[model samples]
Target: MAKGKKKKSQPKGKTITLKMAQNSMELTVDGKRRLNLSFQEIAAVPKCLQKLCEVDELDMSRNLIRKIPDFIDQFVGIRVLDLHSNYLEELPVTIGRLQNLLVLNLCNNRLTSLPNELGLLTKLQTLHLGLNQLDTLPASIGLLKELRHIGLSDNRFTRVPGCISRLNNLQKVNLDRNPMLTEDTASQESVMISESLYVVTESFLCEHCRKKLKNKKLEISNINKVQFIAAIVANMFLGVKW
Candidate 1:
C-alpha cells in the first residue's frame, strides 16, 4: 500500500479555479482538470496535487472515499473536515496530525473503528460519526479535553463506549439510533464514573426513578416528602436512617 500511496505533501504546478474563505475552503476536482479525478474518487489529496491552500473548513461530502488520505496531515490549519455521505471503510492513523481540527463529520460511511491517534487532537470540540459501521471507539478518545459534542447515531455499536463519559466538557450526547443501547446497565454507569467519581454528583441522574430522566425529572414534587417519610420510619424502628 505504501508504494501506491500518492505523494500528498508536495505542491502541484497546475493552475485551477479557486474559491476561498478564512475558515473554510472549497476545491473542484473533476476529470476535466489535469489532476484527472473521477466522480467516484475514493481520495482527494492527490487530486489537488499538494497545493498550499489553507482553510479552516473543508467539504468533500458525497464522494466515494474508502479511506482518509495519509496526505491530509499537511492541513494543520483546518478546524472542520466534512466527509459525510461517502464510502469510507477506515480512517488514516495520520488523522491525529490535524491538531487544530474541531469538527469532523464522517456520517453515512462504512467505518469499523477509529485510529488510536485520533485522541491526540486535544483541540477537537465536535465529532459527528453517525451512520457508519463502527463497532467500538478508541479508548484514547477520552483524552480530548476540549470535546463538547458527539454524535453516535445510526451505527452497529452494541453498547455505548464507556470512555466517552470522561469528557467533562461534554454537555450533550446522542445515542438515539443504536439498538443495543438499553436503559439498564451496571458496567455502563461504572465506566462513566470510574474516570471521574466526583463528577457523578454534578451529573444529572434521577433518584428512585427506574427510567432515565430529562430536565423535567427534577420537577418531581414529592422528592422531599418521599425522603422524609423513609427517614422518619427508619429512625422510629431501630434507629436506622436512610
Candidate 2:
C-alpha cells in the first residue's frame, strides 16, 4: 500500500475588493468610501494585483499614489488605465511592458517628462498628456503608428514638434496654449497627405502664386510685385528716361 500523499497548504493573505465603475473596476481601501489611499497604511502591495493584471481595465484616479507600484509592470494584458488626478511626477520605464495597452490617461499630473520607451506602445490609440509641466516630448513618440489622437494642451510646449506629422494614422492633434506656435505656423504645418506626405509651412506658401509650394520643387515662371517693380524702374532709368 502506498503512503498517503501530502497535501499543500493554501497561502494566507488579505483580500482586496474592487468595485465596478464605468466599464472598469475601482480598488478601494475599505468601507470608508475613499478613492485616495494616502492616509491608509500601504506597507506592501496586495498579491491579488498579480491576478487582476489580467483585467482589461482599471480606474484608480484621484489616488494619492506618489509612486506607481513596482509590480504594475506585470499587468501585461491591461488595456486602459485611468491615472488622472494623481501626484505622479514620472512614469516607470517599465510601463512599456504593457504590450496590450491602448489608452492611457495621464492628465492632471505633475509629470515633467516622458520616457522614450513610450514609443514601444505601438497599439496605443489615444494618449493624454494635458495639464502637465512637460517641456519636451521624445522624438521616439513619432513611432506610434496606431495613434489616432494626441493631447498636448495646457503644457509648456513652445513649439509643436515637427515629428508629430509622421504618425500616418493620426487624425487629430491638439496643440492649444502653446503660445509660440503662431496661427500662421500651425496652419502651414497641418498635415495634408496626398501621393506623398506633405509638410506645408508658411515658407512653402508662395505669395506670387497664392498656392502652396514645396522646397526643392521650384516654379520658374512666376515673378513677385517687388521684382516686377524693380525691373520697370531699371528699364525706365537706363533704357529710356521716363
Candidate 3:
C-alpha cells in the first residue's frame, strides 16, 4: 500500500493567529522589518500598530480608509508609507511629523487639495498624487528640496506652478490628462522634458497642437524663401547696366 505524504510542520516560533494572517497583519519579530497591511479592506488602522516601533515600511494600500488617523504619527521609524487607491479626501496634519519618510504614495484618491503642512517632510524623495482632484498645489511645496519625482497627472491645474521650477533636484513630473493647458504654454514647457528634468503632458504634441506648430513653421519658411527670391531678382536687376 502507498503511504500518505506527511504534512509539513509549522516553523518553531510564535504562531500567527488565523485572523492576523488573513488580514496580512502578522508581526514577525525575527528581523522582518516591514509591515504589509495592504488590500485588507481596513477602514481604520489597527491599535496593534502602536506597538510596532521597529517597522520601517508600512503598506496600507487598496483599503477603505477615508481619513488618515492621527496615530500615524507614532510610526516614527517608518521610511516608506503607501496609502494608494483609498477613499481619503484629506490627510491628517500629523503626517508632516513623519520626518523619516522617504516615499509617500497617496495616488488615486479623492483629495481636492493638500495641506500646507506637507512641506515639513524635508526628507521625502518621492510623492505620488496622481488621479486626484487637485486644482492647485500649495506654495509651500517648494520647501521639499529633496523631492525627486512627483506625480500630478489627471489633476485640474491649468498651468505649472512657479514653485515647481524651484526644485532643482526634481527629476520626473507627470502632468498628463489635464485639459486646461494652452498651446503656447505647452510648446514652451515641452523643453523641460530632457535627460535631467522629465515632464509628461498631453498638450505638448497632441494632433491639434502639432498641426498648429507645423503650419506656423511652414508659413515662416515660405515667407523667408519668397523674400530671398525677391532680393536675388532685385540685385540682378541693379547689377545690369544698359
Q: Highest TM-score: which candidate?
A: 3
TM-score of each: 0.61, 0.61, 0.66
TM-score of 1: 0.61
Clashing pairs in 2: 188-200
Write down the lDDT of every candidate, Cα atoms only: 0.68, 0.67, 0.78
Residue 197 displacement in candidate 1 (angstroms): 23
Q: Where is the poorest 10-residue window by lDDT in model 2?
A: 31-40
Which tens-of-lDDT digit does each residue in 125-241 have in candidate 3?
999998899979988889999998898877776667777777777877877666455567847443222122246343546798778878999999999999988888898889943
Backbone clashes, each candidate: 2, 1, 0
CA displacement after TM-score superposition, residue 10 of candidate 2 (Å): 36
Model 2 Cα displacement at 77 (Å)? 0.9
Give the alpha carbon lDDT tens digit for every residue of 23-53 in model 2.
2344444422222222223323344556556
lDDT of each residue in 1-242, candidate 1, tens digit only: 46686667633322333322112233445311122223334344443524743555566677666666787887777777878887788888888999989889888888888899999999999999888878688999999988888887777666668888888887666664565634676465421211211223235545643244433466564687799888898788986745
